[model samples]
Target: MRHAILITAYTDFFHLIDLTNSFNEDFDIYIHIDKNIYVSPICLKILQSFPRVKSAEQVFHVNWGGRKHVDAILWLCKQALSLSTDAEYFHLISGTDLLVKDLQQFCNFFDKRKGTNFLEYFLLPYQGWESGGLNRLQYKHPLDQLNIKELHDRNVYNRFVNWQITSRRTRPLPNYPIYGGSSWWSLTRDTVNYIYQNYNQNGWYDRLEDTFIPEEMFIQTLLLNSPLKESIVPYNLRYIQWEHKHGSIPAILDEEDIPKILHSCALFARKTDSRISKKLINYFNNNRSSNL
Candidate 1:
């Protein structure tokens, strides 16, 4: 079966080289680079060297607490899916992500599975809130306070909407608890096609991106509600530890962390730097080949 990796990149491309060189899987690699960043000659050369790596065009500028992340993802998915007609699985990866398992083991694990979709689920702690169950912790942006009708109605006049909707007075509307997890996942072609065709075909796109752009809710809700929910693995293979109180991104992996990463029973990890971790890649390659 065909497999593809989709990496979203903004500025720093150092980690990307590590991922590209380490992945032994004979799968297509696609990258979505933020259009705003200027690509240096080294970055361009590295990208062009890999015949399997295809550039995803029409990228948008994304923000931390904005809908740009969701928008860029949607656009990237469209581009990747278009080129990956024969692909059985599409692995959505961040630029800072690294492959823990070699190509053969990774292939074997997924090949043994019957269903295609793989994702993780965790509870969203927004049920008790007064803002209708929209989790503020997950999204720092106070989208709930925005006047939905007014914001939607305005073209460019109401762009500067602040202080008008106070968070102190706003409250949660009492929706059921949302199951959320990591924004990254691996999706089957059938499931993705179903989502693009049926659910997202309506105005749900804008609603998801702009209104309450919770990373976990939108995809989890749609997938669980779909007829193909039974096909979901409910266990994405990436192993990450987010124990810190204010942890947003995973810690950058170094040479010392290689041993723990090897035996983690995970397929991938994130936030590995390119300059500091050549030994980790070599170790992975050696161990992976031996295992095969």
Candidate 2:
């Protein structure tokens, strides 16, 4: 019943520590810290100190809506696959994510469904996205190389997108239908191996490099088109709120959200903060046994 937790983190070292501590010996944690942020040597050493924890030797800048995010994820997957061959499941999650389920509960959930792949997905031309999400792949996205948070850079990015749209410039769509959703997922070892093998052999890496937020689409599109699609459960097992708050897309969870979070069948919840989620984290810590 071994599991691998693959994490991509940028800030908040203390929260990251708590995240790793949540899992027991049955889990191996693989982490990739964003290279753009400065992390103290002691912090890095402390993270690596955990017996089953391994930090990625190679790091990436990990810009938002960038291919580097996807690259970081793939790199983590590669590291986990190479190091933890006996792991039955790999759970891709963020550093801000917290395990809502106890260790036994988490393992039991996955053990009962041995071959299932859990991810949230929707086909292309989804009404929720502008241009039905086609613009993400149909047009060239040079902004991926720049920081979208900077005012000057964001303006340039917006101008490029507008110009492309006005000029009717679009790259030819790939032959396969596109699918996308929340990037976090729990996948079986066989599915992960297939993704790694197929991605390397089919040259999807280069094709996805210039697309916007390819991380959300790459795995979904790849798996949905393959035989493994049948095994996909279509729920990523993470409870997340999409409302914009605290300057992020998914609102950071707080104590106010505790009831819903506890009630949900989700194994984890994301975008928590040490400061904002103090009460929520403490509740879990104090009530660990009762919650289970």
Winner by TM-score? 2
lDDT (tens digit, per residue) of candidate 2 on 1-292: 9999999998888998888888779999999998888888888888899998965443788778889988888898898899998999999999899888877788989889999999899999899877898788888786568788788889988898889989998898877788989999999999888888887435566878678988888999889988998999889999999998667779888898899998899988888999988998888766665755
Task: List, residue by residue over 1-292, the lDDT tens digit for candidate 1.
Answer: 7887877777557667656666544677777776657778777787768777766343665544455666666666676788877878888888877777767778888788846688886555544333544533322353333333354534232442333244343334224435556778888878767766664533444445443445555566667766887888777777666543223345666667787777787788765555555666566657776776
lDDT of 1 at 53: 74
The C-alpha stretches of model 1 lying farther than 4 A from their native spots are 56-58, 126-133, 137-177, 199-203, 211-213, 244-248, 276-279, 289-292
For candidate 2, the lDDT comes to: 0.86
* TM-score, prediction 1: 0.77
RMSD to truth, every model:
6.1, 1.5
Angstrom error at residue 174, model 2: 0.9
